[model samples]
Target: MTAAHRKIIHIDMDAFYASVEQLDFPELRNKPLAVGGSEIRGVISAASYEARKFGVRSAMSGKLAIKKCPELIFVKPRFDRYKEVSQQIRAIFLEYTDLVEPLSLDEAFLDVTINKKNLKSATNIAEEIRRKIFETTGLTASAGISVNKFLAKIASDYNKPNGQKTIRPEEIIPFLDALEIKRFFGVGKKTCEKMYHLGIFTGSDLRMKSIDFLEEHFGNSGLHFYQLARGISNSPVVPNRLPKSIGAERTFTENFTSIIPLQDKLKDVCEEVSIRLQKRNLSGKTLTLKIKYSDFTLQTKSTTLPYYISSYDLLLDTALDLLANSDLKTSVRLIGIQISNLNINQKKAEYVQLKFRF
Candidate 1:
């Protein structure tokens, strides 16, 4: 079947972490709350809608978030609880279709073209799923239904906080044409700025550029933009997707000038990565060390070993070696370690067969 005939739905939970906190704590309801941070330091992992109204957002420093909303309450993250609730939600998706691709604990994509219930209207299936999620978990979710994942993902955010939107195939062109360039998936702040400098501010502006011109300016990603501008995304939703990497990082409250403190931090990060790799029963040959300087400049060094390793001793040795040989131009504010090129069983490629309509 053609790509345009596929039924895709993107479901995203509203302020997942914060919402879960509020649901469990009666007093937190309707109050500005933040999850996973402290007033003195650290970054917020999630912010409640009430906190968002005060300009508090995820990844914002705790000090800045408190400054924006002094009354904001912070709670520690409970990953185990979140995982339990996520499992409940996933069961609901499986009830309708097995072609569910979980993006995270709070969001997923479902290809319901040939669902278990044999539902024809993707929009109705989305609404039903949302209702089931709320009924089962007492959490609100929003959904976007469209012909493909890209359009559905964008539509999911249109009506947030327990609402859903459906972008019909016929509306894809005009909807994308008027959409802001910044709203397009994969277009980051830097890319948006570059596009602005090139006088491309909207989908229509992006569509007006030729493939050759886009490639000349944006390289490989240029072709991606060109295709998205024409509503041409063919990527399918694959279930049980394997992770490409496992990593961990730490940001220091104060930048460190001495190698001693940096080494301690690197040891802690390496241990965390090792634990994660062991938890997943995975290992990789390629190891990368990331350093962010006080000036916000970033540097990365990577080395690929002949054999896979997931031990803390090996990871720390490789990380320390990379750091020792690197040029330290400035104080380091953050450091990270990652292992990629994983050793995992590869599965045969599978595609969802869409039922074509007249």
Candidate 2:
């Protein structure tokens, strides 16, 4: 017999950036717009629903999107403002249950089987959260509720823009059997092509493939697909789990052989990393600097800081120092800064103050 069902709800805001823009400026309420850089070489971060109807999409090049829809209005992202909204929504989720795991600035998973309200059904809790987000933020959120996180995530997208759906335990079998193979979590474009060639187009088709054959073709990924097709996933909804690492990276469209441009890029990455670490209430003992060559070979150099390092100027200087000592043979394609061995501790000990570099 199967174990008792667990309640999981995945909440995702609809076109978060675009919606926020709409909320602030009522003039853009029904107009099509996108959020991203408006420069010659930039991509769309989010597109309003009206823009999406014209084939405008997030991550599409700004030039291409404009070609698709001539009236596409582009706006720059205000990350500080977005971060504020994220915190507000998170606070809303916490009010219902602490088992809330944020997937991004606008998406989260909530386990509400036995919530603060002592709710007995995931569907009821999903409705309440969705309603509250709209009430407080004036933004629409779609919600999916199911017995597991995987199904719940997919269901949230089933109906979007102020929608909510529930997949009860008894509905799991039909839900999996009817789900498209491409809709399976983590199945990318390449995996879909492989599955299609194997004559697996649906959950039923995937269910028929032997686990061994699937694994032989796709390696460990095959096992995950097999289980998902059969409505089996053991992944938990981890809540408020602090990050283990913080890193920043940048990909340059043009390869850089000059030292000036490389340093500029490194400085940019270090600043981003420092800001991220501070926002998360974290500090790291180790710093790693990474580089990718034009030919795609990767190299990294690291330093164990005498103490936790996070200030922007200090990190940039350290990364440059590390780069100076490394062997370089190719033009750089990408540069990055990473901090690891993360912990919440940041208070300096009295002993450290007495003997610092002394």
TM-scores across all candidates? 0.91, 0.83
Q: In candidate 1, which residue ranges exceed 4 Å CA deviation?
A: 252-255, 293-296, 327-333, 345-358
- Model 2, runs deviating above 4 Å: 1-4, 249-257, 278-314, 321-335, 340-358
Candidate with best lDDT: 1
Give lDDT per model, in order: 0.91, 0.83
Q: Residues 77-196, candidate 2, lDDT per residue (tens digit)? A: 887888898899999999988888998899999888778998787788888888888899999999998878888888998888789888777888788788898987778899899989
Question: How many clashes (backbone N, Cα, C below 3 Å) per candidate?
Answer: 0, 0
In model 2, pairs of residues that clash are none
For candidate 2, the per-residue lDDT at 160 reads 86
What TM-score does prediction 2 earn?
Answer: 0.83
